[model samples]
Target: MTEQFGLFDARGLQPADAAAPPLCVRESRRARRLTLRVLPPHTLELVVPHGARAADVAAFVHRHRRWIERARREIASHYSLAQDRLPTRIALRAIDQSWLVRYESEPQAPPRVRVLGDELEVRTRDASNRGADAALRAWLCDQASYHLTPWVLREADLVGRRPSRVQVRLQRTRWGSCSSSGTLSLNAALMFLAPAVVRYLLIHELCHLISLNHSQRFWDAVERFEPNYEALDRQLTEAWADIPVWAHPDARRR
Candidate 1:
């Protein structure tokens, strides 16, 4: 079931079934056309251009109803978050390291996570799966900060480019993005990708600081830094498949 929604209406769009996957409606100022995204967990998101009429949106969705349903079915049939469980032994190829994970349960204790040597340990008061997910994400963020920040700095220095700032976030669709102000935003999932892929991402974003788009100049600049960037870029496109289901707790039910 797909929950239907319009961009604007007096009482909003019609209600959907309780079992229906949520439908998100957003208006994008930069959008020149209507766009549909079938995100993880079979969620349907409709992006309408700014000032799109409600009647038009309704008709568009009606026309694409079958396509949306098929997409939802495909996603539900193929992608399973249960397969993404956090393992007791975790390998981070981007940083060339392996981790032995241990879970400790303590009543009335706050959830805590730490890394020692090649081992990662999580202490939790609540025995729920959600607690473990939170603990793991916290640890991943810590590791991403420790490893990715310096990697960016060293890579930037290689090209003699100094970004204004660098930030790490758990982004779903993109591995990294560079703002016009030279600020680099990296995905925490980069820790799961290969070293070459991670390096390519750093170089790719750094190149954006110079060219800002995928113009010929950008490729030329990227080549100056990484000769094998084209292959690495292609490899990066499939890197999301390497990220385990545990990495995305919110999409677990889907």
Candidate 2:
């Protein structure tokens, strides 16, 4: 799941192109801003201050298309999702072993999935145009709560600790994470997996609260909660690879 558009994202894409809906996500650092995030499915994001015009961002993207495209090409997901249309269904093979495929669609949308019994399943319904992305994103957040809450509590109880809060949201890079202040951030994407796999992410993040690093002790902490952490980690390690074709980073904004 790649955000084709957002506030100040810095990925370079021109809306004029019927090939792909391009937009940029803005990222700033040290008050000197010029970072653009080309979102997945291939697009550009322009990084600017709080008050920036989309038109100005578009110009910036036009200025940096080469760098962005290079980065997009480096990311394997973009290559996989080069051709797609809005509100469409796409079938693809997931590189992750946990689940063979996924159906990204609107909330409570029809069962776009057709299970052929273990072979593989992928039914994607695009809502990128009419806020289907928003709908799918909301469902993903709720699903994360439904799946991760108990798992978090279970791990906390085992170590005689309780989490002060749980945060579930979309993150392009991380599957699950935890903070030292007893707050946990989990990727809503876990909803795509079976319950067992979700449990693995829970223990892994909670253990971070204790060890704070991926040391042997941290792994041991994870092992204490789920003995098969290594195996589960292996499964999750390569997940999210089946994300569909989108676009490449705009050449102007990298």
Candidate 3:
């Protein structure tokens, strides 16, 4: 047996049935677009093409109640988080001879960056939603520009090389990259890293302003600029597991 209820909100009404029938769900209405998103634990996010009626969508949801709930319930159990979630923090050393940690909040509180005394706050409105990664990425880029730019420029000048641009992104893959066009891109995640590692990555990218490929020449250049870089590079490589999601091969050894 399924429960039936009407969903009321500022937008209007919707169908809320724990057990409904199988009906064709339409999302997009105005344009030639239609898709169904199962909001687990028993809800369908229907995207209708423009000019679609909510009544029709609600009816559709009501028609497919049981099947939708069954499917969504399983999904929800795997991914859904409670309203009150704890922050996961990582201890890091700041450049100003200070220690800090960065943390992410689930059901985040709007997009904002804050330094609560010594803690670096990366607040996302919804860690379970789309904008969390992007918001953090933007904040990190801003932080990188502010903290790394002076150092990068100084090194560029010292090395007699000029960079064309600096870009930042959410890279689950690599760290910094240097293109043949004198453009440099850095991982926004680096903001969560120790300042020393961040500085080393910056110098690594600037070194690429000379050698696009990693070779003995590049190593020599890196060592020339930052002696003891080998040890720093090793540290950076080991720090990959600092991000819980990244599956580092050596992470298990630690």
Best by TM-score: 1
At residue 72, give the lDDT of candidate 1: 59
lDDT of 3 by residue, 1-254 (tens): 00011121212223243123112233221335434555322234444454445566566556665655766555434323321222344332434433244546556256565767757666655544334334444545666567666767777887778899877665533566777788877665566677777778878888877786555797689888789787777666545445432211111110
Q: How accurate is candidate 1 locally (lDDT)?
A: 0.71
- What Cα-based lDDT does every candidate model obtain? 0.71, 0.52, 0.53
Off by over 4 Å in 2: 1-71, 74-129, 242-254
lDDT of candidate 3 at residue 162, scale 0 to 100: 80
- For candidate 1, what is the TM-score? 0.72
Task: Tell me the number of clashing residue pairs for each predicted model.
Answer: 2, 42, 15
Q: lDDT of model 1 at residue 23?
A: 46
- Could you give the candidate ranking by lDDT, starting with the highest? 1, 3, 2
Using alpha carbons, what is the TM-score of model 3?
0.50
Q: List, residue by residue over 80-176, the lDDT tens digit for candidate 1.
A: 5353455688788888898898887787777877788888887877444346666787678778988999999999988788899999977654578
Worst 10 residues of 1 by lDDT: 1-10
TM-score for candidate 2: 0.51
Per-candidate TM-score against the hidden true structure: 0.72, 0.51, 0.50
- Candidate 2, poorest ten consecutive residues by summed lDDT: 245-254
